[model samples]
Target chain A: MNTEKILLDHGSGGKISHALFADLILPLFDNPELSCQDDGAILDFEPGRLAFSTDSYVVDPIFFPGGNIGDLAVNGTINDIAMCGAVPKVISAGLILEEGFLLKDLKIILESMASGAKKAGVKIVTGDTKVVPKGKADKIFINTSGIGILPSGIHVSGNNAKPGDQIILSGTLADHGIAVLTAREGLSFESDIQTDSAALNTMTRQIIESGCDVHVFRDPTRGGLGTTLNEIAVQSKVGIKIYEPSLPIKGSVQGVCELLGFDPLYIANEGKLICFTSKQDAQKTLEIIQKNEFGKDAAIIGEVTHTDPGVVLLQTAIGGVRLVDMLTGEQLPRIC
Target chain B: MSLKYVEEFRDGALAKQIIKKILAVSKKPLRLMEVCGTHTTSIFRHGIRSVLPKNITLLSGPGCPVCVTAQKDIDTFIHLCKQDDVIITTFGDLIRVPGSGSTLGKEKAEGADVRVVYSVFDAVHIARENKDKQVIFCAVGFETTTPTIAAGILTAAAEHIRNFCIHPANKLTPPALAALMETDGIHIDGFILPGHVSVITGTHAYKDTFEKYQIPSVIAGFEPVDILNAILMLIEQNEHNTPGLQNAYPRAVSDLGNIKAQKITSQVFEPCDAVWRGIGSIPSSGMALKKEFHPFNATKKFNIQAIDTPEPAGCACGKILMGLKNPTQCALYKKKCTPMTPVGPCMVSSEGACAAFYRYN
Candidate 1:
């Protein structure tokens, strides 16, 4: 793994990725599920319906505040499947590591991934690893794919958003982005700000079982709430309007965003999700989410609108309307 | 919370009207130079140039502290970080600033004693705590930060903190502007003086440049409208052949500036020849610790020799900072030097023109 020269064979889906995995990753996390080699593993469970989902993780600084690529990989895929009112059953991981990656770091990352997967009650069944040269790729990039079983008569997607549905934010926005920025830029304050990276499968399960009619579920990850709502608005062909004052945000996150000229709404999140449910069921959903450890600060942020199809608008705190556009280019830190 | 109605200062409608008035009055192409890096960032961030008339071409000057800091001086600070019992305290932006081989952040990761301090006073506080160790405050910036560093020096001197020292890279803004005006490479039509620095040094500091170069200079605020208004003023001046210093940010800056800040700064430091990153050494452009305050000088305390260090082989940061070339004109801008992995000081500082262009533009 410490060899200077990187070769294309490292990324090849043959013996090189396997050797790199065995020599670097397996010894760190010698787990039963990860040891098994197959296209896909079957989960033995009494299920009403199977909720299958997959995702690829490609974040810079492979390691950041609160969590790293490993935990993010496991939690991200699990949260995606769990949003469908499902319990994550089995998970698969793929690694695209650079040749000069440290063996010790890979061990730590895998251990984190295993711990995260175990906590969610999801086993890593199948996996593949490939390594590119040092300059050809970043230090480490992990891709995770998972499958879960949905409960009976439960279905959730972006298209499920309906008029009069209340939009709820799990916790806060811009925590992950600020944490990453602070860590990367070496900016420190008297207040200790850490990334709120965690698996939300348990919280999602609690919301679903609380007898609330959740119309839609999505995690505001890469493009934040703006992009996520834009996707839902387009998918459902409905208008989404959120209140700026109602959105939950930490003071430190707001301060950093203001100084750095970054928009908190478009900043990234790791352990947060947006749920759309009926006004009648919104109270029940909020109550259930608030009771859970991960969703303690959950709040009803906004609601869906019937006008202006396939668009997201934010009514500012000062009583003005602004279009919440999907983030473009790189989300550079700004002093707003 | 004291709200100052900063929003009203960015009125786009008023700015558009002002722009229209300036364009109607202008006779030829005008080149306005924004001396503050913050102004440069604001100009691009708000797309101010797009709204301005085609006759007005905005040029970025050497207002960025990181961009103007000499490569050799940065290397010297990096060298100080290598010392066993020394702790290098500086702003967060200076940590990632490239020196000879690596940056302070990279060196800190590799076991160098580097700490990011928000204020110069924090460095003094650190020195008091670590009595046995040497605390070297990497003092970098213009008039805005000089007073704070001066105050820290006064505090350290009064406390008799033998361990506290400062690597002074504090440079004056007006002298550098004068140096730029003297250079044949740049042909700036007017000047947009730094707002924050003007709040400390006063508008009077630029009187010499205005008298000599006859360039209309405005001390403009950071807001979008402040920049737009300053551009309008420049265009008007160019049309009427009126070249003098103007103040667009009267709320913070005055003709004389903060007297207390200037008194402390003058009492603690003296003018000296300073080398700029993109620009050559300018006499009386930088500040040094006063002889009575020699105990607080890091260069004297450590007896560190000033080693001549060259820029990266093909880096055009010098030309970029002088407004002779844009960041994209540099061959290594996006390819070899990036925000994540920068090879020059301009790309490192958040307030730097290159960083602004790379991130916002």
Candidate 2:
């Protein structure tokens, strides 16, 4: 098989998928935990609460501004586990490769995945692979399931959000979406804009270690912070009120969104997350998050509310309230 | 904390006052045409249409470059994609724009050598690296994007990059608008001229259209207040029976426009007859690479044939773009031609009328 040319057999479940994984994937991401082939790997550690989470990545232009499918796959899962107020320890990868995908590209992706795992202090413990016909799938789609161990007395969940709980965003909104859109649109500006795709587990770990009693945690990926908050509101049966003025937005991303007729709030993001906690602990959480490199622009943007259950409302910079709902469909650029 | 001139222009108080004046002056069921895609988006984003009186209907026009690109042009670019040693680069918005049956995104997924690029410069850079492949920039947009392509062409010429070429589908705004007025089925009371395009071509260019149609034209910025003020200006003019050109985006656009950008565009391109998606053929509405710059023109370099193809049956994007129908009027709009699975030009182009309605409304 030519490493540069992808074939239909690669996506076939029997021989092609296994050979592709063993030859191209395993060598790049060679870790002891992943070597043991089982239904699921068993970890031996001291008694503590375990955090398990799963995520799927299907971003277009598979490779984008700051990162590609490899790092994105690892970071997404790690972030999910971290959101549970735990330190991510292990991950399992499942790949859905399209037939006729270049093996060289897959190798590059594996190397990125390995590096991302190293950065987030996590190990690839187990994995599975499947390949489909060229037309049956995108070039490559990855799903990652992660497991983490939380420290004693640390608990976090979406339903834990309470009234007057301060809402904090790690950094800017819509960076990942704009970066993806810019790359996808084939529109360029004078400044080079890259995706803010990175593992937020480190930042989350520091905040949890600060003993600020984080009530809830969520990484706003698809549907951005607005949709994520709306989901939390619905799940927790509470209201979320956000101040538009406090939302951190990069000037370039804002300009592109304005020019392309996109709302920053509705756009997708990958690297940022939201934390909801008590007002008293909010200051300490903000300070701890600010100390980290990724959380430099961390801000307390809003608070959870008891009014208007299951709704997310935004107070505009001009002091007007508007309902921020989950984006109904894919946001296409509109000339009007 | 500093509110720039553009920021102040969107003030709600000013917008409310302008809306009041527009309501007071206009007759019942006044139809105003917004001729820029940016204006349409701003109108929807700011919910300007909701705040206005029910009788005052703001109609979307052929201001979107993506919606106006003819099917033949898209087919020609898709044909270029069939070549093994060819890399077809274009803006993200153009990827899903339907040609006849399939889109560029679909073609790319089906193993076509297509890549989305942010700028023409990126295409040039790709050409610089892949000397064996022909890098064709799927050059689409109005005057707002023309200058960048012109600059890229100049750079490619100076750099002597043999692999780079442009499939120039770049159209001028005023000529298409003029064609709409001359054609049947258009009964517009006034015009809301596009702000960004005017910043490039200048507001003076619309003087002829205003004089010819006896309609008031206001080059307005993409803001709530700017659009409202334009409507008020148009209503005021209609009431007084005085038709002329006005500037509501005075901070950015002047009567003359950006002289440097215009000079660059002129140096690289010449006015040519172009096929608009909805409004048939319009003379001098399209820009083509000059004879001296023919080597960099993708159409000439690849001998691309312009084939006549019809839009998908029952798709009202063409009519919608021409201000003859609304998006909800289209049978396929919500059912088949959505943002994810676009089946028409209006659904495909990000700046298209149908796309705007689907996204905002």
Candidate 3:
């Protein structure tokens, strides 16, 4: 119990493995399904469509401002399910730990994961752990798979975006990306910016159940708003037009991005979503989203157009129009 | 947390007024070239091209260090990456730039030790930490980045870090401008000078080129308002037939520029004939490490040889850099070359004209 670092025996499936489960994971997760200590978790579900999602977290620096990989992994899968207009029910975690990783760090990560699941009202039903050599892996890597139930009356898809649909963005952009980049070694900067890695299931639920003509619910995660919009545009065979002045972004995040010669549109966002709804229902959906704590800065950013199908356009702040192409390759930091 | 300068320059109302002025004054078919890659990116990012009159065309010049880097130098970099016990540190902009055979990105994927550093000092730190490994910093930039590389060399020497070195691919901005003016069949009405480079070299650095050519020029910042204002000044100069150089970005650029930075740069590097990627060789356009700093020169210390690499077939990056051709004019532009599968440095470098045009237009 007082082991200072993880060891090979931690994954041996013997006494040490059992102790690690009981002493660390069990008390933290503290759920009946996981307490069974069996090969798999058993659960009951109503007859409905099930939305399942899986994601892996290998973000460098493992820890960053505002959140760490633990909560990021948890919330990532939850948001994926929620984006399908489903209520996240349960999640399974798989951990890959390095042998020399600090036990204290592991406990902190587990604590965050447990608390993140509790906040999202989802249970950590089952998980597996494996220990690798010290140099074989980073400190820790977590993979989470989640399942959610979709109600019968609610249906949403990226292909459902119509010509007269309006696009709504939840909160600000580029907070999570800038936060992680600054926290990285050899690139540290003095700033109070933090990752916006919060569970968006609550906000998604509010908009989904609001009786609006919702078309698409997407989280702009890795490629930011620009890539997500392109995906939706191509899927729906429509064109998108966004207003530059209407896009919400934190001042600190914007400053960092500008300094680094990065486009905020292509930067990553974690706790933000873009919704497509009929023009008449767009205002109602915006108000419903604004009622959530995570959607305070939400706004009607753009609209779907019938012309120029599969292209995304931006109405620049200076009243100019330009194409918004999907992000190509990785967004590298500029030289000057 | 308050980005005061950033907010002030990006004022939509100010940009609108300047744009309106530019629209009103622009009558003739004038082709203005922006000499800096950052300027090109700013113009595109703010949709400056869309706002301008159709008769007024903005041509991208050879200001991007990566886009202008010669094929031989890129080949030399890739060759150095293949050396044993060597760690190549470079700016992120140069990672995907293709040499004749391969790129630094491809070499890294093949298990080469290539690391991206934001500043030259980070490479020096890497060399200090890994004493057993020879860390070569790929120094590719203009006046805006050369002084920092000079400072990094100084830091390495003071600490006696012998393993740290840099491959000097630094270029001078003024010489390239003069070469552009001297080129035959090139018709440009005015020039929007680079703001960041001018911050170091000053408005005085371009005095010789301006006096000789009598071309209207304006140094501009990388903001919508700044670009629009610069465009308006160029239009006025052309219309009035009074060719002169103006400093539109006086907040960062002065007549004399940063004296200490210039001095430090001269202390470590000397002007040499450098071959530009799309353009041919130009005299005194490149900065080579001084004789005293030979030990810090990766090319000499590692005995690297430059290879003869030809430019891509049907690629107009060189013509594009000289403002003779646009990206769409190239046969390999969007069809065979893209940001994901770039056939030229103009498509690889984030600030390259092709990249800015591809992403924004």
Find the candidate with the highest TM-score and give its number: 3
Can you write out model 2's per-residue Cα lDDT over A1-336, one digit (the tens) per residue? 346666766656567667776777777667765666556777887886898889888888888788888888999899889888888999989988887788778777888999999888899888877777878998899999998988888878898899999999989989888888766634544445678888898888888777787999999988888789988999899999998668898877877776656788888777888999899999999988888888889899999999999888776533345567677556655432
Against the native complex, each candidate's DockQ, computed on alpha carbons, is 0.06, 0.16, 0.80
What's model 2's TM-score?
Answer: 0.75
Best by DockQ: 3
Error of 3 at A252 (Å): 1.1
Model 2, position B21: C-alpha lDDT score: 73
Residues B116-222, model 2: lDDT tens digits: 66678889999999999999998888898899999999999999999999998899988887888887868888889898999998988888877787777888887
RMSD of each: 10.6, 6.6, 1.2
DockQ of 1: 0.06
lDDT of each residue in B1-361, candidate 3, tens digit only: 6476887888888888888788788888899999999888888888889989999999999999899999998998999999999999999989999888899999999999999999999999999999999999999999999999999999999999999998888999999999999999899999999999999989999999999999999999988988889999999999999889999999999999999999999999999999999898999999999999999988898876667888888889999999999998989989889999899999988889999888888
Whose TM-score is higher: candidate 1's or candidate 3's? 3
Top-lDDT structure, candidate number: 3
Candidate 1 residues A161-235, lDDT tens each? 999999999898978877877775335543456777778888888878887899898889888888889999999
**Model 2, global lDDT:** 0.82
lDDT of all predictions: 0.80, 0.82, 0.92
Clashing pairs in 3: B278-B318
Q: Which regions of candidate 2 are displaced past 4 Å?
A: A1-50, A55-75, A84-145, A149-170, A176-216, A226-246, A256-262, A266-271, A275-336, B1-28, B154-162, B239-241, B290-297
Task: List runs of model 3 lying over 4 Å from the truth.
Answer: A1-3
Where model 1 places Cα greater than 4 Å from the true spot, the runs are A1-336, B1-3, B11-27
Residue B226 of model 3 has an lDDT of 89
